[model samples]
Each structure stands twice: as C-alpha cells, then as structure tokens.
Target: MSELLKTLLVDQLNVEVYQNRKVLGQVAAKSVALKMKEILKDKDRVRMIFAAAPSQNEFLEALTKEEGIDWSKVTAFHMDEYIGLQASAPQRFSHYLKERLFDIVNPGEVYLIDCENTIGDECRRYANLLTQEPIDIVCFGIGENGHIAFNDPPVADFQDPAIIKSVELDLVCQQQQVNDGCFTDIESVPTHALTLTIPTLISASYLFCMVPGTTKRDAVQKTLCGPISTKCPATILRRHENCTLYTDIDSCGAVEER
Candidate 1:
C-alpha cells in the first residue's frame, strides 16, 4: 500500500490524499469492499450507485478485483445517463458500467436509466426504484466543473424535490466529456442527461468520491475551500457524515492542508 499524503476532516467529511490515481484507487477500493462486507453482515442485500466515466475507471477496475465481495447479493444503479444516446452507443453510461464492472461481477440486479425512453417516465421509474431501499454506498467521481452526476452548477439544487430529473449540461460539463475522450468533440456530446438530484445522491449511507488528475485541481480546490453552494455542486460533500473524498497529489494542488 502506498502512503497517504494527508488525511483530514472537513466538517463531517473525510478527505484522503494519495500519491497518484493508481494508489488512490487501490485504497479506495479496499475501503469500499470492506464497507460492503460490513454492511452485508447485517443486511441481506447491499444497494450501490456508481458513476461511469474515465475518472472512475481505475477505482471500478480495482473494485471488481477485490476478493470476497458477494456480488450476487448486491444491486447496482448508476448516477446518470446521457438523455439521447443510443442504448448500444459506447458513450452510453450503462454500456460503460456494463463493460467495466457490471458484466465482470454480475450483480443480483442492475437498474439502468433507460435514456431511450421518454425522459419523464424514465425519471419516475428510476426514482421509484432508488427509493425502494436505502442506498448502502455511492461510488462516484467529481466532474471537472465540480458537478456530481449531471447536476451541473446551473441545474444543481440542494433542496430539489425530485429524486431524478433531466438536466441540460453546462458548456464546461460538455467539454469535459470530450476531454475525458468519451466524445470526439463538444458537439458530439449530449446536451441533456437524466441525473439523480443533489439531494438524492447525498442520501446515501456512505459516499466514496474518487477524483484524480491535474484537470480537476480547480474543482477540487473549490470543493474543499469554497462556500457550500450550488456553484460547485460537490461542496455538498462537506455535509455528508459518511462521505470520503479520495484524491491524488495532482488534484489537490493549491489546496491547503489541515
């Protein structure tokens, strides 16, 4: 195991800095696996939400390789999906998760956001499924603009009444899809997506946020130092009692240590 560069608490949140993305993923995956095992001891099923993106690749890879996780007892959900993408498109968040983790582990159930269907109906369907049980864990990544899921600053609502809804992507958020190589150009990215609202994501029993790379430096800084507002949606992490932010040295740049 690589040494953690720093460990600190920001209000109720726990933050850990690692040497690089690889080590960060390893440690984060270990923690997630352990938490799942702990939860399974007293619960019949563990419900988890995952983020699908290149930023989550490392952690998801490591997580699938963890030993002794009874994936058959786990039900999986994804945080968001591009509204108009074809189901078979490689850019589809469902496809991304299937290729990376779902197929590999074969969870007991996987409730994917059906972006090809009517957006409103899909939102209600998924929202109902999410509310069926309390979320045991949420493994997610912070966007370059500090958005969580597709909750871009313009659409983020800390007190949103709906659990899931369609949202227009901000320019910066669309550009990030290109930067992450998910799209060839900004024009190729979907303008809207169905996403779990801020309130929905923060409702999880535990949140493990994996953010890496220098491109995320500014967002990471704002997430840790800025006021808890919709401007940087990830700032809500500060309020979650069991949330942990795992970052590498590159992403933590310019943020003062406690």
Candidate 2:
C-alpha cells in the first residue's frame, strides 16, 4: 500500500505496480483477505482456488499473517498439478501448496488433484467438486508462456466445455518449471498435467493474479497489450469483470517503457 508506482486499466483488468514483489504480495494479500471477509459476511463458507509456484510465496505468507479472515470457513483448492511426481515429492504442486499455505492457515476443506488416480477419473472428480458450488475467489499467476494455471497456449481453450482436463505441457511451459527451480531440468518436469480449464478459472467471482520478477516482463506485457487470444492465454483475464493484476517494478518494466 505504500506509494504504488503506477495503476492502470486494460479493459476490465486492473493493473497495479509496486516497488517490489514484497510490496506487491502484501498489498494483494490484504485485498484478497478483505474480499474473503466480505464474501463470508453473507455466506457460511468461501471457496477459493490458489495457484502453486514460488511466485505465490510472498502473497501466501502475507495472507497467513492477515487478521479477521476466518480461515476455517474457507475451502481451498489448487488450480493444477503435474501427473508423474510421487505423492511425497516436494516439487509436486499439491505438496508445495500444503507446505506454504494450507498447513499454515488450515482452510476448512482442501481439495487437490490426485496424481495417483487415472487422469480421466481425477479430472471428472475434481470437476464435480469445482461445480458443486460457485467459486468465490481465484489467486493465481501467469506463466512465462502467458499461461494461467497449466493452461499453456498449445492446450488452452478459451471456451473449454470441460471444467478440468489433461494437457500436454508446451515446451516453453516445461522450461518455465526449471526456470522457477521447481524442476532440475526440462525432462524432469511432467509432460502432462491436469488443469482447471480457462472457462472454469474465469468463472470465479473475483480473481487476483500475482505476476512478478524480471522473467515475467514479456508475459506481463503480452497479457496487458495483446488481443485477447489463446496465443497469450492469460490475456483472457482482460475480459474478467473483477480481476486485479499485481506486478513489481521488474515485471512491469516493459509496459512502463511502452
């Protein structure tokens, strides 16, 4: 909340640039926590979908430090997961989320993709849970390939009918795993993943997209400037009514230079 470097609008998406990821995270956490409280004022529970990646660390940590939000009344779900990692693998998206966020605040219910299950069964199961009730909030990040969740350009569908489906990782998306230090190399990253489709993620009432670091500069620029197309899948956010994009000076640098 310190003097924001800049704030602008791209269609329906609101972009706010902060001094660094730390401030970006703190501000996003506060805004999300406040929205959660507002939703809980009338509903007994809030269903939130969260993304798993190092980019989410600061915000997740700051959100745990937030006060007045009844974490026990929140139902948590992650947006995607790799198919091959062992259940105990630290690199697994589910494991990453549990260690950082879920185990800390302990949402009342937590739903995650099961890598052990057949891709078909798991997708159907998670899709059911997702549609059981309307999603209140989605906290996510855009990939270096401009992906949302694991909805990489090659497999992304702007109007996907299936709520969840299996997707082959695009080369760029696979390399991003190594770049983020989630995987030691491209081959170690799973070729396929189960992700909530674009329609599913965009269905949420509110969306908070945290994108930071210098590596994300081009993706951020495409997300804000390109035509709304699957070529830059995250560009779909521009059509969302209540989505906010939080960026640090590093990630916002390209747009600033424009």
Candidate 3:
C-alpha cells in the first residue's frame, strides 16, 4: 500500500521513530531530557529553545514532566510571537511558554521576544542575545504549512540577516493556527509575527521536531521530500547533523511508502 512517491529525506532524520503518537511524544521527551543532561556536562550553562503550537501540546507536556532534567542550569528561549499582541495576551508565545514549560521549571535565564517593543530594535536585541549563547537543544514544531517558526512560506529565509524579524503570515500559516484552535477564527489572528529565522533555528547543537496528526501529512511530505528551499521552511532540517523528528502513523503517511 506504499511507494507511490519518492521518499523524502527529512522523514528519515529521526535517530528513533515510533508507530504510536503518544509513545513517540514520550520517547522524544525522554530523549531530550537525556540529551540535555549529557550536553550540560561540559558547559556551565545551557540554552534551550522551544516553539508553541497545538502540535506540540503533548510533546511539551511530556517534556516538562520529564524527570531528572536540570532546569536550574538551562536558559530558555522561544521561536516566535504575534507582532502586535501583548505579552499578556492569551495568544502570546511568552505566555504559552511560561505556562507550558518555564514556570514549571526554573531555568537559569528565560528570554522571550517582547512583542510590545519596537519590532526592529527588539529583533536586533534578541539576535545579539542569541549570538552570545551556544544553544544546546531546540524543541520546535512544523506548521501545517511547513513553517519552522513564524518563518512563513514566503519570508522564511535560510540566510535571514536578523535572528528575529517580522513576517507577514501567509494564509495557510494563519489558518493553521486557527485550525489548531489557537485563535477563535482567522479574523482574530494577528497577521504579522516576530519569528526566529531559519539560520538561528538550525544553529542549535541538537534539534527535536515534534509533529503529529494527519493534518500535517502534506507538510510533512513537503518538508521531508521536497527540495531544501525556503518554499518549505522546515526542509532546512535536512542539513542538520543532529535532528530528530517525532511523528505518528498518520503524519508519517506521506513518507510511509519510503
């Protein structure tokens, strides 16, 4: 029942793969906890990056509950946020991270892109902060549109000059947020967003991407099989030396034939 199309490379990045979504999420969470423990051995401080999305709800929940992770030595960062939204806004990435991971764990430093600040200045400041630290691991999600962060299809560049910058949300990207129930409707979602570009996202020592659900099959295919281009932002993972993609049977359907 498989083999209709050529296998995509990104689909094969997993150091380990699982047949069950729940088990996949659990193994990924444990793998990250273990990886961080190993990386922190040689470094005094470790930085971690996280992304916010419905696809990550289970993964983040599992990761936050992971036993034995040294949260005290870790500094945290997130991938993106809506440009005009307040940090206190229900839709803000900062709030999502704080509730889902940071507040639950006492990290050494937790940096969030201040969406209320001037976009350009805030972008540069965040970029400088990111440059000062060597990221140990990055946990992220692929948008149903294949965006890595807010790096929507058109503006997601592999060589973005700034670590964080504003991007106009493509319809598919915006719709995915709503489809995932992050927003009540498309009209309620902010059209502009501040996002960590591809270069910075791919800069981490290890990257763990959590993707699940049949809604993501097309995107999973594009990201894994399509050419490594900005057209499908997440495709850049194909070049990373250490990247793990966690997905269930449904999301894995596109590449199952491989």
Candidate 4:
C-alpha cells in the first residue's frame, strides 16, 4: 500500500490524502474490504449504499476486485437517481452501478430507486426498504458544489425526517452532471431526482467518501474549514463517527493538515 500524504482527523471524521486518485482509490478500497470482512464475521448479510459517478470509477473498480468479500451476502443500494431517465439510459445512476459494480459482484440483492414510478410512491417504497435493515456502509463522493448525493445546498436538511425524498436539483448540482460528463449539456440533465436524504446517508455504520479532482477543491476546502452547516452540505460528514474522506492532491488544494 502507498503511504498517505497526510491523515487529518476533523472531530470524528478521518481525512486521508494521497498523491493521486488511483492510489487513493486503492487504499480506500482496501479499507472498505477489511471493514466488510470484519462485519461479515458476525453477520450473515451486509447492506451497503453506493454513489454512481465518474469520480467513483477507480474506487468501485478496485473494490469489485478485492478478495474476501462474499458479494452474494451483500445487498446493494444506490444513493440517487434521475427522475425521468430510462432504466436503459446510460446516464441513469442505476445503469452506471450495474455496469461498474453490481454486474461484477452480483450481490444477493440490488434495490434501485425506481425513477419511472410516481415520485412520492417511489420515495415511500425505497425508504421503507432502507428501514428494513441498518446500512453497513456507504461509498459516496462530494460534489463540486459540496453536495452529497443529490442533497444540494438549497435542498439539504440535516434534520430531515424522511429517509428518502424527491428533490429538485440545484443549478450547480445540474451543472456538475455535465462537468462529470454524465450529460451532454445542462438542459439534458434531469431537473429533479429521488435521493436518500442527509439523515439516511449518515445512518450508515460506516462511510467512505472518495472525492478526487481539482474541480472539487473549493468544496473540499469548505467541507473541512468552513462551518458545519447545510450551506456546504458535505460538511455534515465531520459529524459522523465512522466517516472517512479520501482525497488526492488535486482535491486537497487549500485544506491544510490539522
């Protein structure tokens, strides 16, 4: 394993910096694999949530190839999905996960948020499923605007009561989809999405946040140095007891070691 450039603990959250995305992903995946092995020691099945984006490419790729994980004993869930995108759409978050992780691992079960269903009905259904078991882990990333999942600054609620909800995507959030090359243009991105709320994401027993790229520099700065507020939704990560933020030199731009 490559040595980390720096390891900072902001309250209960751990931030690990590496020379680049590939190394960061490898280390993060190893950590996740070890955690899964530990959890499986006493549990028959583990539930996990995943983020689907180009930013997660390396991490997910490394994770699927990690040994010791009985993929059939894991239940998979995705963090968010565009409201109108078809299941076959390459831009659909579910399709992204299927291609990158699910197909390779073939988990025991995969519960995807139904974007084609009635918004309210789908939220209720997915939320109910989430409550059926505690989430063992969540692999996610911070957006350029500091959003987590689809919980953009304008829509994030730290004390949200619902486990899942439909939210209108903020302009910055929509533009990020384009910046990540998930969509050709801003107009092509979905205006709204079904997302696991802030409270739901934090409910996981462990969180592995893989954020790598210069584009996330500003958001990373605010997430670590700014106030713990919804203004920079990713800031809430610092409050989680078992959350770790994995970053590369490009993303750790101005956030000095603590």
Candidate 4 vs. true structure, TM-score: 0.98
lDDT string, candidate 4, 25-87, tens digits: 999999999998899999999899999999999999999899979988998999999988877
lDDT of 1 by residue, 208-253 (tens): 9999999999999999998999999999999999999999999987
Better of 3 and 4 by TM-score: 4
Candidate 2, residue 139: lDDT: 99
C-alpha local distance difference test of each model: 0.93, 0.93, 0.81, 0.93
For every candidate, C-alpha RMSD to the true structure in Å: 0.8, 1.2, 3.7, 0.9
**Against the true structure, what is each candidate's TM-score?**
0.98, 0.98, 0.92, 0.98
Q: How do the residues 79-139 of candidate 2 rate in per-residue lDDT, one tens digit apiece?
A: 9998888898888889988999999998999998997999888988999999999999999
Please state the error at residue 49 of candidate 2 in Å: 0.1
Off by over 4 Å in 1: none
Candidate 4 residue pairs in clash (backbone atoms < 3 Å): none
Candidate 3 Cα outliers beyond 4 Å, as residue runs: 1-12
| Full ranking by TM-score | 1, 4, 2, 3
Model 1 — TM-score against the truth? Answer: 0.98
How does residue 165 of candidate 3 score in lDDT?
A: 83
Where model 4 places Cα greater than 4 Å from the true spot, the runs are none
Question: Looking at candidate 3, what is the lDDT of residue 242?
Answer: 90
Candidate 3 clashing pairs? 8-225
